[model samples]
Target: MDKRESKIPLIRFPEFKEGWEHKQLNELLKVSKKKNKDLKYSKEEVLSVSGELGIVNQIEHLGRSYAGASVHNYGLVENGDIVYTKSPLKENPYGIIKLNKGVPGIVSTLYAVYKVKDNNADGEFIEHYFSLDANTNRYLRPLVRKGAKNDMKINNEYVLHDRIFVPKKEEQKRIAHFFNVIDTKINQLKEKQNLLEEYKKGVMQKIFTQKIRFKKEDGSDFENWDNTTLGKVFKIFNGYAFSSKDSCENGVKWVKIADVGIQRMQRENVSFLPFEFRELHKKFLLKKGDFVIALTRPILNGELKIAEIDDFFHNSLLNQRVGKIISSNNLIFIYYFLQQQWLINSIEKNIAGTDPPNLSAKEIDHIKVSIPKVKEQEKIAKILSNIDNKIAKSINQIDNLKNYKKALLQQMFCY
Candidate 1:
């Protein structure tokens, strides 16, 4: 190895002095061999394996059935051991868990149990470290060779042999502790964001219900808002179906209704359709402020989202399942208003069919909304937008903390 000054900051602890030592993950850890039997239990312990954390009692998963249910034949797990969900939803590739509850439980064969060898590495540090890196899944992913595209099944054998890196013992604890603090801050921010969302919801309900009123330039009330159908205020432009084969490696961005995530549109990692496909789906060209709502899904079945295309989103095409709303009303105000619990409930009530419920343009237009003057709508939109900005900032802070924790993990272990 070429001798060079390390660019990374080194920690000086009371008990440790060396910069750090590197080692293979197999050197400091061993995988569990206790096989889980298929025997069923009448009064099972209700154990579940957390993706980053080890096995915990039934309460952790809220008593959800895991891997088709089996008895407690598997070896018991302790705190700080790493256990993963063998089958995870595709969108959520990493699954979940970075900490474990020290509780009595057994895991299914679907879970791979990794425990740090005695004092060779800090279990807490390793747990936090492995939790952060998606790279670990690089090896673990291929093991999941079967199941649905959304939920693929993985085996323990694959995870147990997966190679990982580790750092010196002292560095492990420091890094884990450092990341844990950052994680706490992230969780706190998330809680604050949730509160802000709740506050906005409450305000929306009050403002729309006439509990709070808006005044005009003449200082007169806008009057009890008129009850209007959706079609009256806006025209719904349904997107055209573009063939999947027409999608290109790099071309004009296409917004499938699925591109609208649970909260906002995912501008990055967007799929692209070629110019020829765009010609075929010319009517689906999306404007900057267009509200694209998913009309079909069990995934986002009850979800309504507004897409805010940035400068980069020019020439993007919207998919047929997405309905673009061009409103005479303030679009942001309408978007948040639809996000209100009451509106979602109302829309959900009118929903028909069981096998993947779909909403039609007529059904969308029939959804009733209390309409205020355009000016008043703009005012309401401004207030809600401020709250959303705060929420967005908090969300960003959470993301930063998660990134910090992940970085700390990579540095903590010696492999």
Candidate 2:
């Protein structure tokens, strides 16, 4: 209990002054060898471990059971049991471990399940301890042996041999509870964001279908929406075919096909072109408030790969296979209409049977859409924009909470 001689977390509760004790995971947990031998759990109870979502119902998380033909050989996971998947993830290359807080489920043989040996250690605390990617990778990388196929070669029992620092049972509970509260807040914000998105989707459907309409400032009804092809109302200009040699480390930002996301631009791994190229590629330059869409693999999950240019990407040169939308009419209105499911379906139908699905300027220009008057368009855009602002705020709050939790994990645990 000597503060100077023992290991301690960077952050600790005032009531707990003692340093954390170093103990092997084997001393705290035992491998669960229980199998679903007697058909106790059905294939419907199959579970999967996600680095972000922890242990979740396989069918619910992935939309279908990736289970093998037989369920009899699956591993049984009881409530509070720890499960480790040998499958590598982008964040956790060695695999991931999670504690099952939901109903008892069965996982594939690829997973190794465990149970706490006694009340001396907390399973949730252990899960959180390994929550940080670096901490988990540091602990598992050395112990794991890779097979010829790059699969993890360690067995269930050997996985628990590593040692880790742990607090007393009381401190463990406190830390776990504190993280649980943060997790709850994050989940609530996520739920709110989801609901707001769903609400916007429903409202958009009603407004576009004319099930609902916006009245004029004088309380009079606006005219019916006009049906017209995209080509008639807007010009679809394809980006210039910039070569890889044009790419540079520092210069004008280049907007490639990969930069376009659903309603936003992805700034990660961004490429740049020489600043002077901005003048050479004047037609390819995207300005603030410009609407752009990916022409290569344009549709994903029933949504168009479209984004509105922001200040950060203003005057950025656009690369090939991405289209810039220009219209004299309400540009924001057109942007919102392009997001409609029906438009996406039409685009898909046009590109059906095509490999590496692409959307040509001609194809996009040919799609028909219903549009209201400019005033009504402005009203609709304002309404949708307000909802989007709320959704964005929720996303920002959730990300902040996750970052906060990540920071807490770094300090609260003895790495």
Candidate 3:
């Protein structure tokens, strides 16, 4: 093969022996001029181009339509049409290209839609090819001129003038199908995770509300749950105020507010303190099985920013604005009970008008809770923990699959 035509991906199917062809995108695509000029598609049919979800219904994705008063001037996007969103994103500053694989819809004028020009190329292949951030950035960086407002300044037709390498039609189809299978697997895992979460939520509601109750080993009924304020059960205290300047490279892990996720600890961007600080901040130290909650902005997306310290975060120093809960009662039972929606509602009611939504030790202590006998608490906690373990496993599997797909994208496409 000629040197100019020798461009090929690092990984290719055994059946494909030839190098990929180098050509301008315009050779395979053309700007879509179709519009909703006749008012055939309403604002209800408006679509939004998402980097992760591709082209999706604007209302369904965002929970509301952001379309302007007029819809007749919107671009009409048909199935398999390529849409470019000119809006800048953190990952794709030059914008992103996505294929509309769903029903025909109308997109706002900010989006540029295009159609496949001929049988020489596949739309799905183009979509997958640009799916990699490096691929999209490299192709668009030089061509996308930024306006004063940081918006994309390139014309829709000009975007297709960039050169790209493409395999034969058959190879293109195979590659697209391969990635599609991976995507399907990811989606299936996500669905399973969602169902498990829903099941857990429902079961937790029933258990906490006393709609369902556990019994003794003999299957006889246990005593009714007793109501008590959180203060009567657990001693909640905020962590020590650690100075950022004192942070060290290696030593005790620092559990900052950002590290506390909903029912999980986020280890990304972790910071550490000097080993000597552990003795100085013994009161703020967190051990394994410790329960902690964010005092500032305690709730996110309707979920509490609370989690139990696991092995990975054991012996860590908790930073200020994070409350540590210590209890003589079954801590696991209390942790699960706090996750109940009704309990969260009670917390929200206390902090209703507070700006930035924070919680004080006094206010948290005043919150009421219901508890059963120690044996019943142990049984209930065991059941809920089992469900949580399954959810965590599903999440880990999804993350692994996503990482695998990311690796495949890097090797399967020529940069």
- Which portions of model 3 show Cα errors greater than 4 Å? 1-4
TM-score ranking, high to low: 2, 3, 1
For model 2 the local lDDT of residue 319 reads: 88
Worst 10 residues of 3 by lDDT: 1-10
**For every model in order, what is the number of clashing pairs?**
7, 0, 0
Clashing pairs in 1: 23-415, 24-415, 166-413, 166-414, 166-415, 167-413, 167-414
Cα displacement (Å) at residue 275, model 3: 3.1
Q: In model 3, what are the clashing residue pairs, if there are any? A: none
**What are the lDDT scores of the predictions, listed in order?**
0.64, 0.88, 0.88
TM-score of each model, in listed order: 0.76, 0.96, 0.95
Model 2 regions more than 4 Å off: 1-5
> What's the lDDT for residue 216 in model 2?
99
Q: Write the per-residue lDDT of candidate 2 for residues 110-154, one digit (tens) a residue.
A: 999999865788888989988889988888998898888879999
